[model samples]
Target: MEHANTAQLGRGPVTSSDLRRRQNGRLASIGEPLPIGMRGADAGGREGRSEAPLPLILRRVHPLILLSTVLMCLATGARAQQSSTATYSVTFQGNWTTASTPGGVVGGAHFTTLIGAVHNDQVTFWESGGTATAGVERVAELGSTGTFKSEINANSNAISVIEQSVSGGGTGSATFNVTVTSDHPRVTLLSMIGPSPDWFVGVSGRSLLNTQGNWQSPIQVDLFPYDAGTEDGTEFSLSNPATSPQGVITSIRGTGKFSNVRMARLTFTLQSAIPPPTPPPPPPGGGGFGGGGGAPRTSAPSAPRNLTAVGGDGEVVLTWEPPLRDGGADITDYEYRVDR
Candidate 1:
């Protein structure tokens, strides 16, 4: 014991075997963790002497100490896993019913561009009963999502945003995928109600994590129409003035509200369970230009068919069917003449 204490204090040179005994005694006396890589013979302080095996030395450690060390490692690993980013597959389906309001206002249900973001609980794009932000006004009044996306991107906790054109009278859909972490587990979405002035539908601050802090799969949420409160026009028209004091954002109600109508549906799926989209297979004979036999040539495309038009507020929408014969080439552009 005297020699062990003296050797540990470095008062005398000792063999690997002697150092190993002293090292154990020192740890027992001080209750301190061993210095990383510090060992008897393996430490190489002395010459020609073998050191004690690490496994043998560990066996001598207190059971409680070993248990605590293992627990610490596991806790660290769990935290790392919890903070890792996860991918979410999100889809938005437009389900608005087309019709006119009692006030003689057009309510043809066609969605504008879909705009949304994965954000933290603290971030907000628009809230019921709150004043509409400029970003919201842009989408509501003009069906633009550029400003809305910028607003969300400025937020520190925003994870991702999606803005794509999606419109329908009763059924339409758009899909996007985003990566999120535990810190940003909520999603918000918005789309303008076309043919309506300052009206839109969306979901806000929808959480992806469950009560147990686990990611939930296949979250389905219904959407409803809400007035942006930026314009006073009662009908879907471009001719309107900005409300003096933008009214409080509110759910669509009253004779103007499409109460009986469903506007849209949002679905959130977990990527872990479902794979994402993949590129389409190559064309029958290799793809891209300068390849085998150029794309099959077809007869000249027939003229556009079923041409129809509708006049609204200050703009007109035209609808038509594709040409019957594409002239062996895909139709790349359209030319339409508007006669006043």
Candidate 2:
């Protein structure tokens, strides 16, 4: 015997009346409000009481569930508010030549390996009018970077270190890429002016972000020679003794021996940027039952499909199909490694 409010599936062609009765019965079973004219009555014209409405359903939701949902939304918004990372190609363009320094040029005059860090305002790697650390002294006097690198690594505020050197001349350029976030937007770079007692050229605590909190591109800074204040040598290639008491770092420009000319220039050009993610929208109706926001969280893309490799003469050819899912953002690159 068929029930008074049963949905007939895979039995004959079901009528519209059958579907309406099935829907009403399901809603009533779950304590959901019935449609107009269907209240207080069953499909077979039997009298029955209707279920409570949406407000009652909301009241049944646990307090903890609502609190958890609110916390999740707040966390999502915090992640979205984080600033993006910006990468730049920092180029050290050395102009150390007889023409620039005039009477102070010496043979084999070259810049040592460049070393620097991208840090925050809380730390200043090396600054004018400040006494040089052991790392700074070595870099300015002997063109060594070991101590400086260690110093940078130990500092919690330093984010990245850049190290590269020009090849074979006083007048050359070397470029390396560096990345910086809003929290550590300042840059400090230094290189020794070789054959000098304690001379170096650099910029200290220069910020890459502008006042409007945007990354600045193609920044050009004129470099001047500064005395490390550890040695008392007045001319390049002179064997001078260290100062009795360490002095403050001071600019050597227009100080008798050095001419008022820039020894080098630094140019930072933007390479790429990864902007922060956008937050999900808030729940509808200020949150509660049937409130409609909160989309699914995205993650790394699925593995590639149909990967294949063919061996050749001293080489290999590989190919594969794109992943079935790309999470939420577009895939920008792929990295591969080979193990032998």
Q: Mind giving the per-residue lDDT tens digits that candidate 2 earns over 1-340?
A: 1101111123232222322222333433323555542322222233332112111111122333322211000011011224689999988888887656888568888999999899999999899999999999999999999999999999999988878887666887898888999878999999999889999999999999999989999999999999999999777864789997989899988675567778999999999988765655655532211121233235545654555434333222344555566554343223231111
lDDT of 1 by residue, 1-340 (tens): 0000111122222223332322334441113334432322212222111112111121232323322321000000000112545677778887654432333335455788888888888877789988898899999888888888889888887878866677445466878786766777787888887777798889888888899878888898888788888898876676788888779888884446465456678888888632223433446744322111224333334655655434333222334555566554454333221111
lDDT against the true structure, each candidate: 0.57, 0.65
Clashes of each: 8, 0
Candidates in order, TM-scores: namely 0.53, 0.60
* lDDT value for model 2: 0.65
Off by over 4 Å in 1: 1-82, 98-108, 167-170, 253-255, 273-340
Ten consecutive residues with minimal summed lDDT in candidate 2?
70-79
